[model samples]
Target: MKKSVTILFAFIISQFQAQPGNYYQQSAKYKMNIDVDAEKFTYQGEQTLEYTNNSPDELKVVYFHLYWNAFKPNSMMDQRVSGQGKNGDSRLQKDGVSRLASIPKNEEGSQNIHWIKQNGKELKFEIQETIMKVYLAESIKPNSTTTFTMDWDAVIPQQIRRSGRNNREGVDMTMTQWYPKIAEYDYDGWATFDYIGREFHAPFADFEVAIKINKDYVIGAGGILENPQGVKGYESKPLLSIDKNNKVTWRWTAKNILDFAWSADKDYKVKSFDVPEGPKVFLVYQQNNKTKAWEEAQPYVTKYFQIMNSHFGKYIYPTYTFIQGGDGGMEYGMCTMILGEAQNIKDLMGLMAHEGAHSWYQQMLATNESMRPWMDEGFTSYAEGYTMHQLFPEDLPNPFIKTLDSYRAFIKKGIEEPAVWLGDHHDNGSAYTYASYVKGELYLVQLGYIMGEQKLAEVLKQYYDQWSMRHPSDRDFLHIAQKVSGMDLKWFHNYWINTTKTIDYGIKDIKYDTKSTTIILINKGQVPMPIDFSVMTTDKKIITYQIPLNMTHTWKDKDMYGDFSTMPYWPWTQKEYTLTIPYTKSQLYVLGIDFSQRIADINMSDNFIEVK
Candidate 1:
């Protein structure tokens, strides 16, 4: 009994020590019943929110995000669209005019609260555009729970962004970020921001939602249907197309998820498939000649699951739905909504692969994507490229190079914001796309080159295991990488994310005596990274040399390009390096820096030279 008690005590200490400093995440149980008038594009809802303050500090007030309220004219999102001028989101513009600026009164969306009560006492509140601040009737004590109930009405805007009705793809609804979500509170306090058609940060909570809509419309959603017996053929077949005036109440429940989204269409066709040792996948899309590719790409999604599970991380959710949604793809909770119509199978599979990876990163490893969009968007893009490579080898051997090429083009454009910028704060749409998706993907690819690729693979899986169902900042991800690689990586993450500096390395010079050949490498860019220099011999043999960065304190335990001789450390301050090998120039055919092309070297023209 004494030995057992000692082991148990040590285990508890170890688990506590592994957590981030002062890390406490609060959550709530949201029980809601909504009635939708499909023709009017309006809804009424009643909410019962049971919130708990897990943080050490007591809570005097709380906030909620009224997302649809941004759809009105002169809103912050409308002004932001006009402010970006020609560089704003194209979807939000119509012939150089902001779409929201001229929306019709009835079509415009808004959320109006009737009243809010905390434990049966009415609370005073203030509405700040899309955000609502509620002064508590009674202060919520730490480690204690409080129940609040409210009634509200909402108008669904015409399809413009993720949350809308009647999208370009003819998806009747793309209900995303559609609720009056309670803002997340943690060590950072209340995370409340206006809806600007950007990223989101949500608290993980259980939901018991009952939505009333027309019975004829087939509803596909992110949550499991709790009353499937009542609504027959919901999982595998289309519901009976009956009277539009008749309403059917769909009771859906989800546990430990941040949000729930559902789309309804009379034309939606459902197909179900299972991945071995993985989640059950539901393909719900409107079928037509344009959407034939969705059917052809069904098997590819299974392959994608296999690759992601084998490499990055396991899909923690039991079910994943690929429902046809708005104009483009958006991920939420256990499912993702994507456009079903694709010109080709590869394009369909590519989008599915991208959104599917989000199930692992964005959906489960729920980061405050508004703050660290790179980890959410970039990591998903990285996984997408890798999965596409496996599915279609003829397209490219190393798909990551394609993203590097895109990054180089954007770097040449001379407009790059730091990765630390919030998702909505980027000056232009291009900057946001490149930073969050293109360059963000390069962050992981470069890290793989810095630490061994195997180490990076381990780091991703460990990160998923530790940070899923919670919010992880960029620093949290970096700590996991440092732990897995057993190296000092602060310099790498800081330089890469905090600055717009580029990486440019070149072969400067080569000299040879009868017994030895020497090579000189130069760093032409501001960012400093370890070098993997390789040489080709007269006998057609390729030999690689690894130069460890001084600040890294060590070299990769395993190199993806195979084994190599460890060269002396290269100091970041030094502009050039001279390396000598015990071979004559006559025995060498060529010399190059990073033949794998994994490094995002902005200037690659001078990276290689013939020495024979």
Candidate 2:
């Protein structure tokens, strides 16, 4: 009996680590053919899915995401937006009211699955709003593969959300989540979060898609154009003649992408910029004055790819399409849909940098966003901040000061949910948005402050190389950081992510003599963080002092600023700590805590003391 129990325990542990090379995720291959009706604003699709079960559990049922169903009147997304009152999404509101509540039936979006078959046999299935569960006739054994064939018809919603038609920008269609997408199956089982107009998560797969549309419409999609010569926008490659019905079929293919998206319009002008050792950046938009900004942004976008590739991991795809479609910017597999109209080239470049950064954080890393949104949006925001700083260099010591301020604002509101809260189920939309985008982004910045910026950069590159194709959790990243920085970061994760604690450190007291000055630092807030203390002398030279948290048990090796003298670790139990510097009291002009503004200290006014 003892031996049997031990064997069972071993078996369970083995099943948990079943993925290939200890970083396993399920793989999918999709072959889809879509027929679009430009006049009616609808499409018919046929999909063949080949899914491999990399998990150890046997599959009795498979799920697919019917995301368009969320756009209907009184749907979950509509109701959520309506319930949020004025604090809800501005795009979903029209005339100071919820526009989704009044959408016309013809304009409403939906995917109606006609039939689903497993292998050669039809299967029993049920549609649960945004999720469709299909029961398999034969259970898929562990380490096996299954094929699912589906036929569906979908209506293009009248440009209300991510997947829509005739956006405000006048783009004819934005084809995102327009298909019966397969839901991700991981160690957490099926991820079938209802589409509440917040976040999306999916398994990475190879896509082969053929879109048939009116010959007049030009196409921009996520993947590579398999037959660019047959498409209109891809010039000077000659276009193939339209079919008998005045429609043309455009073929596209992408490998190891999370999802497939495409947009079509009658007036899109295509411009391509080639980046050395990176993807050919394609900017597609309607010809207008706004397009000039996009044109001016060509060199900046090229530089973005170059910096991101060298700093982060390399971008695998050879092409990336940036289309002027949708309410705002949204990232797809190898492309991004961004609103074209910008005030200037700089604003457009900022938007493009944020969305382009998603190509690495969201598209490549592919974290389970609904579960851990910060890993997706937060990491991307961090990259966006860095990219912007590099693109438009300012004299500010810390370029990520805005991100840190945003986090402080969220904390001051006193409505912040734990960063670990489910992406769609937060108490309010502000909590979800701020927690995911702002706090998540600040996590990296503050971490860089804690563990030296140079070390953080190394860890980020190593993380991207190891976990690009695999979804990584907060703990996974912390583990990587711990290994790289030789520091214990478990307390950092628990305090920052799992709780709503804030960090506040102030100068409690100061004493000085002829040869040395002593400053008392107090941790008044619930959260704890490493301190980067600095002192400015009357001679205009800055003397730096570093304090490592007792929890870390290790100090950051190097920082972006000049080297600093090490101080004792601040213990969490002890509220106040004293540090005595070699500078005399009369020689110091100002004593500041975190003068770089990297730490998210709630009460900033008390962080600095003026020498009298």
Candidate 3:
């Protein structure tokens, strides 16, 4: 008993020693009250935020994000639309007629000002240019607390992107991010940037929003509605209480969130269901002819929730709203704005699942999106693909759940591109989008293959648990992955994240002697990925091994032996590598390089070698 107790104590000590803490350690708590008049598409809100400055450096200024400014004409975001055509291209001509209309800058506007007593004096402040850097009268000491108040207004723009104004027959509004908000600050400082067509990262806080809208309209927002009394018999009072013309004010509050958004529509049909331990899934679709398709999509959405919660982690929020929006789906905290019209049920489900997964990556694990968009968008895309394959295995061509069919199609069509590229590259827009989404996901899939799923899942969970509300860079993610996988993946990271290299490993030659056999592996492509060689004998026995060729040990090594034979390792430099295996002449029948087809081996036909 004493020996066992000693061993247990030592194990506990080792675990404590190995625990990592530098990723994300701070938590934020805030309170907000929002009042909205839906007819005019104007909202006013007060946010009482309590921020804990956990970093070592003292903070002197706070930054808030004015995201709605992106919709204004001639803004940086508008320049993207103007420079690139409406679909993000400059050469295409406008088609004039569409459901979403582009609003001029003069029509769309937002104002945010704070009045506070700082250092025993009253100070008035106003914000412009999307991100406001407010200088505090007194410095917020490190590891201390501070309270601040903000008053802001948003004039909704015409429905162009995901957040806008529209009065369709079956939909009244699909408002999202239609508010003046604050950016996030962490060890890396404030995340303030002009709105771009990518992802979002916000600081976690509490929200209390009150919205006044037409009595005929049903509202869905980011948080739980606190006033059940107001909702009951809401349509009775036409002139005073709740009327078609007069606005009915509804109050909402959400705790432990980063942002607030809401939607309202008179023709909205609502369906509510609960997950086992997750948030209540609310499916909000148009009450018109689309109800049948929305109803058919419920089971798939529920399956996604189940699979995601079981695989990644539990849904942390209490309620999740899926409302009809424009073009594609966009994710917000606790609420996901999506377009529910799809000819194929599978496509709709896939879109919903992808956006829902973003709730964890972008909404929960709030990494600095402007700097490292891939950490959120890329990872979420990969997770979405995995969830789709898991739920619909028939769509996959292989038993390994790698979706060999889609991968082969992408390769054969010459659509493959490097995963690492600048966000504003001057390539074909379709190619850039493909590389950013598809190839980025492929990179994660390759990472999964490098480290088994169990280890990869553990790393992903740890990443969320540690950096959920913090800003993490690409290096941070790579470090955590290496620590969790117990593998030095610097080569993988360097070649995949920093360069545009392709992977091609094949069987160069095979030699058989009376006593032993030897196989030579060649690096045919520019990139060097860890090779998984499979050796099958005439007797039907198989042996598998991994070859580690990283940047550090790319040169030829004469002394090393065993699983990783003596060979020169070069990353995007050397063309070929030779490996000798010890097997009897009769024992070796065929040898294959990267036999599992896990790596994105660009060339595969030359991967097999036969021994006679």
Report clashes for each candidate as comma-separated counts. Answer: 0, 1, 11
**TM-score per model over all chains:** 0.94, 0.96, 0.80
lDDT of 3 at 104: 58
Clashes of 3: 11
- Candidate 1's residue-wise lDDT over 1-612, tens digit each? 999999999999877854558688888899999888888888899999999888777899999999998898999999999888778888887665788998889889888899999999999999998889999988999889999999999888987887788888888777877778899987667888677878888888889998888776677888777776555345554353333568878888888887888888878887778899998888888889889998786689888999998887788777888999876788888788888888999998988999889877787888888888988899999999888898988544257988888888888888888888988899888888988887779999999999978898899989988997788888899999998898899987887887888899998888889999888999999999999888889998988899999998878867766788888899999999999988788888888888788999999899988874
lDDT digits (tens) for residues 1-612 of candidate 2: 999999999998887676533655788999999999999998899999999987778889999999999887889888888887667777887544788888898888889999999897999899998899999988888789889899999998988887698888789999998899889987777999999877788888999999999999999998889888887988787668689989999999999999999999999999898999999888889989866788788788889998999998899898998999998989999999999999888899888999999989988888888899888888998899888999999888698887777777777788888889898788676888788888888888888889988999999998998888888877778889999999998888888888888889999999988899988989999988889899999998998889988998999878987688888788889999999998897899999998788898888989999898
Question: lDDT (0-100) at residue 100 of candidate 3?
Answer: 19
Q: Name the TM-score of candidate 1.
A: 0.94
Instruction: lDDT winner between 2 and 3, please give it.
Output: 2
Model 2 ranges off by over 4 Å: 1-23, 94-96
Estimate the TM-score for candidate 3: 0.80
What's the ranking of the predictions by lDDT, best on top? 2, 1, 3
Better model by lDDT: candidate 1 vs candidate 2: 2
Candidate 2 least-lDDT 10 residues: 16-25
**lDDT at 472 for candidate 1?**
85
Determine the backbone clash count of candidate 1.
0
Per-residue lDDT, model 3, residue 257, is 69
lDDT of 3: 0.65
